[model samples]
Target: MTAIDILGIDIAKNVFQLHGADRRGRPVFKRRVMRDQLLGVLSGIEPCTIAIEACTGAFCWARKFEELGHRVKIVSPQYVKPFVRGQKNDGNDAEAICTAVRQPHIPLVPKRTKEQQDIQALHRARQRLVNHRTATICQIRGLLLDRGIAFGKSITKARRMVPDILSDMNNELSEMARDAIAELWDLFCNLDRRIISFDKKIEAVFRASPTCQRIAKIKGVGPKTATAIVAAIGDGREFRDGRHLAAWLGLVPRQHSSGDKRVMLSISKRGSQHLRTLLVHGARAVVRTAPNKDDQMNVWVNDLRERRGFNRATVAVANKNARIIRAVLRTGEPYRAAI
Candidate 1:
């Protein structure tokens, strides 16, 4: 029997397909194993380099594989897709992963630690609650508009007006309509409470982590962005430099160039949308307040905004912030504000 030098696994909920190759890249075995038999089969094989596409549950499997004495590489699905032969299926994907792993200089995803996962989960839960709150507010506004009781777009304004609108006998609101509005108001209040609870939890996480605290010192990074950056990228050693970090976050412009001709488009927007949105929002806040401040960053932002317009300048600031964040994470240094 040939000794396997590399193994690729296409993981699914119930079934897993594997393709193993020898030192000379010759196929040693190709088979599908039930989820229950996965570890048992792998335990029988000698330690080898295992490659798997980074997806849902990929990190968990990576940790498990490492524990079994095999070095695991988590390749992004995009890189593996190029190596796929004909039609796509579990067998072809497993083969493509095997081929992609052997390619030189292909970047692999770092396995996230349990703590990082926990922090990210918290952020995701909070984001979901925020989305729900927005939907609830919109629903309330729509319902009020139907009855000709319009309130300002602001949620605070709506909250204040809701009680008066519900209780006032002057309005033509039906008893059933008033009751419905009251129930919706109660839901709105409940969502606000839940969101605040999540915010407190995130704040606690930021306070407890020294790295997050340091990150929060940067101009455009608040507790949420600070904790998010720390949770998303650990030490920031995975990338080549700060620019690479910005590019990874999709802050940099997309390129379409061939030969000497060059064309640049909007941002690639390839990575985490949540992180990019946070950074952009923070940058917009900085840009809005830049005119009143005399700091070096503010001056630069103001000049950029004047020359490139507000939207471009905001993105430029976000890109710069992303790079600064990378540098701070990489060097373990505190951010110094310029006078």
Candidate 2:
């Protein structure tokens, strides 16, 4: 095994592009390795700094290389984008990642643990099921409305009212439409079961995870929110402060400034959409029962509601909650609601 430095990997499902450079930033080794042979291939080489774009399945390989006595860093794909030369290809991307890694201050991604990935898988499944359920609900609504039947805004309400509406032989509805609703109802039921199963699995995970247990103390955070935040940010110490964490989560307002003028736009809409959604939803839930909430957040939200409308108020509270989450996680401190 020859010594090497700054090895970059462009990962795919089957084929992986590897670019190894010498100590002075000159290209030395270039080859493609099959997916199954990666560990053996890396094991054959001497330890050095490894760089790879942060994408799906990259964390596992990072862990593997770390075990192989190499320093591995995952570069954000967005940060690597500018480094790509005129044309984009696996080799170019690998080289770009290599170049990006040499910078001492490049922001690195937090690697997820196996347990964090498990929680993420649950979230992915639940999101899929929710999408399917919504589609089924929309179909039922459209079909029923075509036959002049009305329903409330929610799928659960549609599921409940459909049976009774179809139970009686109403002349307004045809047999074909009734059968369609029945099929749609069955589909909705299946999706509902899947969502409930996901809830149970996530709830069980929350119960068993000590880290998640501690995070759940934040007023707006629940089992899902806590687990998602834990998985997304890992230890949260990587961030310099809660403000940076909030910016990473894209909850902070976007800024554009000039010599004498400054403009603020909407949030960046980057980072984990699911995490942002969970935080916002949890914040709204807390705001719904604001008087009962015993924290500075409750007071803030209450004051905002009197000034801003409900929608803006919800997002404002969520942004604050994101900051609180980061601070708590970074300090390893439990949430102590401010009076």
What would the TM-scores of all predictions be? 0.95, 0.93
Task: List, residue by residue over 167-276, the lDDT tens digit for candidate 2.
Answer: 86954788987887888888888888889999999999899977787888877789999888887878897788887888888888888989889998888877989998
Runs of candidate 1 exceeding 4 Å displacement: none
1-339 in candidate 1: lDDT tens per residue?
799999999989999999999988888989999999999899889999999998999989999988889999889999999999999999999999999999878877867888999989999999998898888888878988998878899888987888888889889788888888788888888988998998999999999999998888878899999988888889998889889889889999899999999999999897789999999999999999999998888999999999999999999989999998988898988988778
Which consecutive 10 residues in model 1 have the weakest lDDT in total?
A: 103-112
Off by over 4 Å in 2: 1-3, 291-295
**Candidate 2 clashes between residue pairs 3 or more apart in a chain or in different chains:** none
Query: Hey, what RMSD does candidate 1 come out at?
Result: 1.6
User: Judged by lDDT against the true structure, how good is candidate 2?
Assistant: 0.85
